[model samples]
Structures are given as C-alpha cells and as structure tokens.
Target: MKVLQNYIKATNTHNFEEVRKSLHPNAVYFFSDQTCTTHEEIQAYFENGWSIVQEESYQAKNVNWLYSGSDSATCTYTYFYEGYIDGKTISGRGRATNIFVKESDEWLLIHEHLSPLPK
Candidate 1:
C-alpha cells in the first residue's frame, strides 16, 4: 500500500526519474492507447502525457487489495486525473489495476493496467 501511494506521489512530481524509482526494472504498463514493456517506452509515454496535460494531478480512490503476500501484492482502484489542456480545465476517471513485487525488501511496481470507465 505504501508503495502504491509512493508511486502515485512520484507520478504527481511529473519527473520520470522519480517515477522510475518506483517501477520494477522489467515493468509493463497497459495504457488506454498503448502498452509499454520497457522503461524507456514507459518514460516516453509518461512524459508525453505530462506535456499534453499541464499541471496534471492524479489520484487513486476506492483501492481494493485483491491479494497480498510476502512477495507480491495486487490492487484495483478508481483513478481520477485533472489538468489544464489547451488552456481549459479537463478531468477524467478510470479504473486501474496494479501488481507489485517485493525485491530486496523494496516493493516495485511490476505491472499496471488502466482503462476508461464505461460511457
């Protein structure tokens, strides 16, 4: 849970380096539009989003931990994001699932999948 919180905080920083610290070396991310299997790709995707959504803020709500063990954990949550795009404030909500694994006593995000809520 702490790792997830830290990851969200890192994302809010809008600094790829900070976000990278929370991700596993072989992390995979499934976004609404694309999938990133490598850290380089993930960083690019994040940076592009940050550029498009200026002053973006993201948060997770109603987090439910599906499983948790000494080595791994999985959770699902409703995610909300708000920011200025094209000088207009915009916001959206979606669903997210995250998988984390403990390595060297540190929890690192191994996988994440995000999708928009139903119309």
Candidate 2:
C-alpha cells in the first residue's frame, strides 16, 4: 500500500521518477487501449500523459484487498480521476487492480489492470 500511495502522489503530480520506483523492473501494465511491458513503453505511458494533460487528480476508493504471504499483495479499488486536457475537462470513474511483490525491503508493482466505466 505504501508503494501505491506514493504512486498516486507521483502520478497526480506527474513525477515520473517516483512513479518508476514504485514498479518492478519487469512490471506489466494493462489499459483499455494498450498494454506495456518494456521499459521504454512503460515510461512512454507516463510521459505521454504530460502531453495530453496539464493537470490531473486521482484517488482510490472502496478498496477490497488481500495479502498473500510476505511477498505478495492484491487490491481492487474504485479509481476516480479527472484531467485538464486540450482545453477541456475529462474525467472517469473507473476500477483497477494492482499487484505487488516485495523485493528486498520495498514493495514494487508487478502488474496492473485499469479500465474506465462505460460511457
């Protein structure tokens, strides 16, 4: 949860480095329109958001969670987000599941699946 909390803070502020630190070196990400595996692709996923939005907000709510051993954890939550993009306000009420693994002393994200609610 610490890693995820930092990730949300980093993402809302567009701090890519902190966002990167939250993920494992080989993390996988899935979006409605895309999936990312390599470092370049994952970095691009975060970088690209800067081009489309000058400001954004993200909050996780209504969480259902579980801890599996000392090395693994999983959680599902309502993801609330809004962005200022191209002179318009865009937002989504979504759901996401994030998986994490303990590496040494830090929890790093191993996988994530995010999708928006239907229009």
Candidate 3:
C-alpha cells in the first residue's frame, strides 16, 4: 500500500526524480501507445509534459495484488488518465499489470503492460 502511494505521488507531481527511485534501472514499460525499456526513456517521456502538457487526473482501479517475497510482487490494475495539451483535454483509460521488485530494500518497478479498455 505504501509503495503504491509513493508511486502515485511520483506520477501526479511529474517528479521524475522521485519516479526514478521507484523504478528499476532497466524496467520495461509497455504503454497503450508506446514501450520504454529504460528508466531514462520513461523519464524523458514524462519530461515532455513539463513543457507542453498538464495532467488533469489519474485514477487507478482493479488493484489485484500478490506478493511473492519481501522483494517481489505483481500488481494488476486499470488506470484512467486525463491530461490537457494546448488547452484540450485528452483522456486514455486502460488496464495495466505491473511487476515490482524490491532492490536494496526499496520497491522498484520492474515491468508494466498497459492495454486499452474496450469501448
């Protein structure tokens, strides 16, 4: 629960630095429209928002969770994301499954896969 909370905070604030803390150095991120294989790439993707966009809301759902050990877990959830670009609201809501691994006593995201919800 606490790890998820920190992840949300890092996302909402667009705090890449904080986000990095929760990400494995070689995390794999498969988004609705793109895939990133490294923390730096993900950071760059979010960094773009600071210059041309703003997040309006981000909501998570499903929340099916499991723990494999003190250092490993898998979380399945849906995310509803809304953002503004050039004053226009763009929304993308989808289901996501993420695998998290604790490294050095810190939970770090190791992999994520996101898919669009059926209309």
lDDT values for all models: 0.97, 0.83, 0.79
Which stretches in model 2 have alpha-carbon errors above 4 Å? none
Writing each residue's lDDT as its tens digit, candidate 3 over 15-88 gives 78877878888799897778888777888877875556686566677788865578788888888778888899
- What's the true lDDT of residue 35 in model 3? 87
lDDT of 2 by residue, 1-119 (tens): 56678778877778778788788998999987899997679889878876676677888888778665688989988898788887799877888999999989788889989998656
Candidate with top TM-score is 1
Task: Tell me, by lDDT, which candidate is best.
Answer: 1
Question: What's model 2's lDDT at 66?
Answer: 66
Which residue pairs of candidate 1 clash? none
Question: Which regions of candidate 1 are displaced past 4 Å?
Answer: none
Query: Where in model 3 is the C-alpha error above 4 Å?
Result: 49-52
Arranged by lDDT with the best first, the candidates are 1, 2, 3
Expressed as tens digits, the lDDT of each residue in 43-110 for candidate 1 is: 99999999999999999999999999999999999999999999999999999999999999999999
